[model samples]
Target chain A: MTERFERELMRGSLDLMVLSVLADGANYGYLIQKRVRDAGGDMIKLQAGTLYPLLHRLEADGVIKSKWDHSTGRKRKWYELTPAGRRRIRDQALQWDKYAACIQRILTPALAALPAK
Target chain B: MTERFERELMRGSLDLMVLSVLADGANYGYLIQKRVRDAGGDMIKLQAGTLYPLLHRLEADGVIKSKWDHSTGRKRKWYELTPAGRRRIRDQALQWDKYAACIQRILTPALAALPAK
Candidate 1:
């Protein structure tokens, strides 16, 4: 099996991934972690340390909002996209697509030019 | 035009892009920078600061080797890939494809789920 993409490759797009998941609905940290994991199909695993900092950063950046909920009988913090975050999702997603396409252009010919494996 | 991807997005894939350019033939720093810029269609501009350090690192990694040529009378440093560098290109390219696919899976549906702009 091909090795997973190195962490650096995933770092740039991670905010987009989490924002995308929230587009489906509001979620707490654990669910966000699971969704990213499941969406990447074994390529992504958002650790708590990574996820919380990212979530906090996004909140601090005004892209997301969080609130405490005790309605579930235990206090849990839920996160949802703000208007800025929705726009961020749109913006970052577009940028990510373009970047991926550029990579494809370089990679395809480079691979073709290689002596066949 | 959409804004160029932020530096972080480009940073992760920088090595792959340079290696791809080198795969075409032995090249000096300026040409590698030019090829990446042209191929990215204005999305990439591999500044000398970024390019040289990366070249040195790749050289240190033993994936690429460089030689000084005075035949041009400019004492240019030319670089070419080693066998390991070629192998790195293949492995990185495949991983990038899978990772891009994963992003697509999450992004497409997430975009769909958004309220119409």
Candidate 2:
């Protein structure tokens, strides 16, 4: 990725991406990181430093809820989307679609102006 | 668009979007804003307050150049992508494609996991 695009991509959308992982089900931090990394084919890495703070902010905002899980013989904090978070992810996904479509339209006006094939 | 998505979208991408407008040809500030607005179908608004500073930054970064136009009996500043700007846009567009594709994979792992139809 270009340096500018990489910098801007991280600055903008990390939170929503993390929330998306949690949308599937409750997940611990390590797993959450892995899930996002694997899902993006490692193109987008969510470091612990970035992930934890965002998770905290989302929890504090009541978008997600977390609880300790000792089922694996070790303490882990598992997180899941709250009702608000589910709603938030749904809304964010829609907005992303709209925004992306708009950008695509702007970027390819010549193509957009063409009659549908 | 959701507020978070809008805020993040502007934070991350206004530069490239502007660069894209200039990528087509040199244009004055008003026309730059108009092209972007019209391109996005008004979903993405680039207020003058946000656009001029970004244009100046790109200029300072040497990605774009500007000069006064007086052929119409009024002074106007026209901006165009420098050679560096063209290369930058090309690189940025490729990065955006990769990053967006990565995000799509992460966002819809379920669909991605499905076998080819």
Candidate 3:
């Protein structure tokens, strides 16, 4: 809204989105970026600078595991969720729902109470 | 959720929530705290330490204005929206809706594709 996407608002959510991308199947960095962009439309864009560090952190946290594949002509590091990551997606998704509902509870009435334009 | 409130998620939102509180009418620190807490149910709690600084920043930004009132036998600083604040509420509320919807767009299908519990 402020000429830039609200990156601060997106901070806590990046992990969950990345995990969700892997939920369907393994993906390298670029494809995960594409899935989020496609799903989010203009609202989300995962720049490579932001995405790689996040992937490293998730892998370091043991939620994801990676393996390099050279069977195809091009080499790629593909990531998949660990069992723990599956549990996290389930947990974080529930938490995201609760947080969204909390904001709505305050926001809906606040919008209604606003003065006419 | 974590044992603690997701303060990271609350970071960018505190400004909007404080402005929304002032949308109804002027309110002093304690009343604003009560209103946000009640509206957010168990999900939000605005401690004085966090609330006061945010109020001062909003005042500095010129989106909100404050007055010291002594009519009720005790001095209290009451805050209300400025004309700019009204515009901010409208704009921020719309942005918030867009952001929420974006998350839902990605999250709903992600949830559906997850393995059954």
Top candidate, metric TM-score:
1
What is every candidate's alpha-carbon RMSD to the true fold?
Answer: 2.3, 4.9, 2.2
Off by over 4 Å in 3: A1-5, A72-74, B1-5, B71-74
Q: TM-score for each prediction?
A: 0.93, 0.85, 0.89
DockQ for each of the predicted structures, in order?
0.67, 0.38, 0.58
lDDT per residue as tens, model 3, A7-52: 6667677788889889888999988999988877766767999999
lDDT of 1 at A66: 99
Model 1 chain B worst lDDT run, 10 consecutive residues: B1-10
lDDT (10s digit) by residue, model 2, range B26-68: 7889999998888776467778998889889999999999999
Which candidate tops lDDT?
1
Candidate 1 per-residue lDDT, tens place, A1-117, comes to 233336777767888899999999999998899999998876777789999999999899898999999988877899999999898889888788788899999999899999998
lDDT of 2: 0.75
True-vs-predicted CA distance for residue B57, candidate 1, Å:
1.1
**2 or 3, which is superior by TM-score?**
3
lDDT of each: 0.87, 0.75, 0.82
